[model samples]
Target: MNYLVCVLLIGVGATAVMDLWAIARKRLFGIPSLDYGLVGRWFAYLARGRFRHDAIATTPPIRGERLIGWTLHYLIGIAFATILLGIWGLTWVRHPTIWPALIVGIGTVAAPFLVMQPGMGAGIAASRTPRPAVARLQSLITHGIFGLGLYAAGWMTSFFYTP
Candidate 1:
């Protein structure tokens, strides 16, 4: 149905925008946002019904790892859609506001900078990465993209329920 297509399109568009932004950061500041090779591997593993986090970061991630990471990222976006649906139902689905997206996006940043980054040996906020400032910038940008995805998903749901 058209609604389904819209959901896919918006979710994918937001994610793609985020990814392209990452690539731009790499070229401009000399650091990769994610491992595209890894993303491809994730699809392959999905057929096998298994995904691995691999815990690799010193170098470019392998195909499988990036795939797993990206897959998880997408699924997370889908979850945000679930939240919108639960609260607002069909009506909320049709026209998701920017506030929810922005709040969720910004709110999600806490763990990575405070816990994950340091735990990963990145000092703080991924400061150990090739470009810390750039990494932080990418995080903010990517989270914003995720928020945009929430809005898209909600809008798509509206098309389906007509409320």
Candidate 2:
């Protein structure tokens, strides 16, 4: 239905905004953007019955992993957007306020902290990283930016929905 399409569009748009922030962060602060290829490698191993890695970056690279990782990144974004819509309902989408979107966007950090990082061997919330505090802060900031992106996307969506 139209609602479904709207959710997908908002999700994709918000995620794109997040990515743009990453690029800007890298350019302005000398921070490196995440190499989603590791994500792909981890996921590729899922097919072979491997669920965890001591160090995903050291794991053998999977063929087409770059493609897979990038694709998964967007898919996960879409999933998060779907979660937002499910929790807030279509009425929220029609009105498109920033607070709900921001909360959902910030809340999504759990997936990376609890699920993705641990699975990739970075430890829960990047505990095993060389600089755990820095890693955690970076994650928080990135997710916060994602929250802003969600708000921006929601505003755009509202603009389109208005009569």
C-alpha TM-score for every candidate:
0.59, 0.95
Q: Kindly list the per-residue Cα lDDT of model 2 for residues 1-163, writing each as its tens digit.
A: 3677878888888889889989999999999999999999999999999988999989999999999999999888888889888888778767888888889888999999999999999999999999999998898888888878877887788777743
Off by over 4 Å in 2: none
Question: What does candidate 1 score on TM?
Answer: 0.59
lDDT, each prediction: 0.58, 0.87
- Candidate 1: residue 15 Cα off by (Å): 3.0
lDDT for each residue of candidate 1 in 14-78, tens digit (9 for 90 to 100):
55656666777779978656654444444455556643333324333344665566776666555
**Global local distance difference test of model 2:** 0.87
